[model samples]
Target: MTALAVTITHEPARTILTLDGELDMVSSARLTDTIDAALYGGRQHLVVDVSNLTFCDSAGIWALLRAERTVSAAGGTLELANVQGILKRVLDLTGAARAFRIITPGQLTSP
Candidate 1:
């Protein structure tokens, strides 16, 4: 199978990591590396734009949780944005929404 693709966009004060394709065990490392780079690279706020995310398994959730911990320990915040569809529902169902900051799609464009 072809490897999944994740696109990252950097903005002032925040970096948007847009996760595309599937986020499974293989792709989890990529997400971790990207989030780490953004968080420690002087970006005070990291936003994960999951608008284009097609699939997310348990590994995906683990990746997010690990990133959340790193960002929290670093005194920074990671905001999850543009999460919809099944992923969004699953997050809410699992109560993971309360673990980290979440921004709706509309809010992402406004600020």
Candidate 2:
């Protein structure tokens, strides 16, 4: 398992958290930490960039769901930008595809 790193990039009015590496049992906490920080910051609008994520497990899915709920509870919006690979398929199969505003890298150019 690779160490997951979440890079935070501040957007105009939202915070973009770019998650790279593997989100498995070994490194899921890194994701939780970064996402929790974003939520606590009260940014509300979150864009999770998972394009570079190579792998994910159930823990990763749980992390995403927890963050999604947290954002909604705060009356904020959460979106997923650049999700692909197996992670994308799982989200779709689980009917979570509609829960997030999934965007591609090109679509994020508008900021």
Candidate 3:
């Protein structure tokens, strides 16, 4: 199993959390905690960079949705960047794509 690796980068108006590896049940909590901490730190814009994310299961999707709710409740916004492959398909199929501002790989210079 490839453990999820999260790298955080602070931008002027948004915080970017780049995810690598598998975001499964075993690693979803780390993401939740990171997001909670960022929110607590007064981050109003969050961008999840999933360009290097190799796999994402139901738990991962839940984590993303939960993050959206948390951020929204705090009067913030959440965006998913570098979304492609399975992750994109899953979100589209589940109708969760409409819940987020998705930044496809081709739309950005880098994630």
Candidate 4:
């Protein structure tokens, strides 16, 4: 199983969280914590860069959904970037893609 790593960076208008490795039940909490930190840090726009994400299970999807809910509740927006491979297929097949504001790397410019 690939280990999960979440790296967070603060930008002028948003917070970017780059997720690498696997996101399963064991690592979902870490993602949640990172999301909470970014939101509480007073960021209204969150960009989750999943380019390095290698794997994701149902729990991972749940974690992303939960983050979305939390961000929306705080009047912020959550966007998913660079979703590809199996992760992209999972989101598409599950119709969860519509739940997030999906963007390409080219669109993730400073706002």
Which model scores highest in lDDT? 4
lDDT (C-alpha, whole model) for all candidates: 0.83, 0.82, 0.90, 0.90
- Model 4 stretches astray by more than 4 angstroms: 109-111
lDDT of 4 by residue, 17-79 (tens): 999888989999999998888877788899999999888999999999999999999999999
Where's the lowest-lDDT run of ten residues in candidate 4?
A: 1-10
Candidate 1 per-residue lDDT over residues 32-99, each given as its tens digit: 88877776678768888888888899888989989898988988889999878998898999999888
lDDT-based ranking: 4, 3, 1, 2
> Best-fitting candidate, measured by TM-score?
4
Candidate 1 Cα errors over 4 Å, as ranges: none
Query: In model 4, what lDDT does residue 75 have?
Result: 98
Worst 10 residues of 3 by lDDT: 102-111
Q: Write the per-residue lDDT of candidate 2 for residues 1-111, one digit (tens) a residue.
A: 477888998877888888888877788778777767877877778888888888888888888877788788888888899887788899999997877889888976654
Q: Which stretches of candidate 2 lie over 4 Å from their true place?
A: none
Report the number of clashing residue pairs per model: 0, 0, 0, 0
Ranking by TM-score: 4, 3, 1, 2
Better of 1 and 2 by TM-score: 1
